[model samples]
Target: MAALIDAIDVKRKTTFELEGVPYYCLDADISSPTARGGQTLVRLRMRNMLTRAVFDKTFKASDKFKEPDLQTIPATYLYSDGDGSYFLDQESFETLQLGEAMVDDALELMVEGLAIQIDLFNGNPIGLTLPAQVELAVRSTEPGVKGDTASGGVTKAAVMETGLEIRVPFFIKEGERLKVTTETREFAGRA
Candidate 1:
């Protein structure tokens, strides 16, 4: 039997069907807003339960949903090679490889052997969400000193080992590990 859920409960484990296809949408919002001009808009964050694809859509507040069955599974990050990204099923001990296209925006935050939770439907992997923070090493950057007041306060452009560039504090150096926020890629602190 299919499960039913309200739009407000979308963030949790819930399901709904659209055109006969089941989908699990997470961290979604469905609400009506009153604007300055007295106009109203409905916003939504939806993920395809089958494909694990996410998208935002706006609709009239009058619309409603019919629920579907939602399931959850635990997965772990194995490794990534030129071939593709791989994950190990915690419960089944099965490993699966996902193409670059499947990872989408989450690719930029990946690190070797990092474990993360994945949303799936009917045994197909859909979306990859990473931790809020991650630590990485600096690969290259110009040197900076404590008393260097020549460039504003104190900042340096450092390239992470992953090849992503970030503006770090003046004291950071090559090979030094630093904490970074996955959402903004901003430097958090020295690790």
Candidate 2:
């Protein structure tokens, strides 16, 4: 049997199970009553682990949720094909496949041999948790001419090896490795 957590305890990045499906909390807000003896509401922005859907719902502060059987393990990017993207679990040496919907925009940040974390629910792969930053090589971009850096905050479009296009600084050139922040999908710095 799993332990239960009260709604008031739920916060950002919390994982709990409702019914039989696992849910990840993106954000949580608690609203207290202005008058006496009023019920408190815990509004949460949650994402469905299996379906990758995001929605908002409100629950009473006293509501209880069962902690989910979720685990994250290190994995290495293997390849992608007609079926979906593949990864090799570093801990167990097992091969895992995540569907297109599950991979989604994350594919743009992945490259062969990249290290990442895979989220598992009830011993089955549910979704992927990307690293905060990743190193990607620029596949193509306009040439950076001399003195371009004189204009501060200038940027140009660049395509990464994994097909992600991002606005890089004007001094960035083709074939240079860059640090990219996964959450915002923006250029971080030189790698």
Question: Largest TM-score belongs to which candidate?
Answer: 2
Q: Each prediction's Cα lDDT score?
A: 0.71, 0.94
User: What RMSD does each model have against the real structure?
Assistant: 5.2, 1.6
Q: How much does candidate 2 score in TM-score? A: 0.92
Return the TM-score for each candidate structure.
0.71, 0.92
Q: Cα miss at 174, model 1 (Å)?
A: 0.6
What does candidate 1's lDDT look like per residue over 101-143, in tens digits? 7776566666777667776655677656677888888999998
Candidate 2 lDDT by residue in tens digits, 1-191: 89999999999999999989999999999999999999999999999999988999999999999999999999999999999999999998989999998888899999999999998999988889899999999999998778878878889999999999999998887889999999999999999
lDDT of 2: 0.94
Q: Given candidate 1, what's the lDDT at residue 108?
A: 60
Give residue 4's error in model 1 in angstroms.
Answer: 3.0
User: Candidate 2 — worst ten consecutive residues by lDDT sum?
Assistant: 143-152
Off by over 4 Å in 2: 34-37
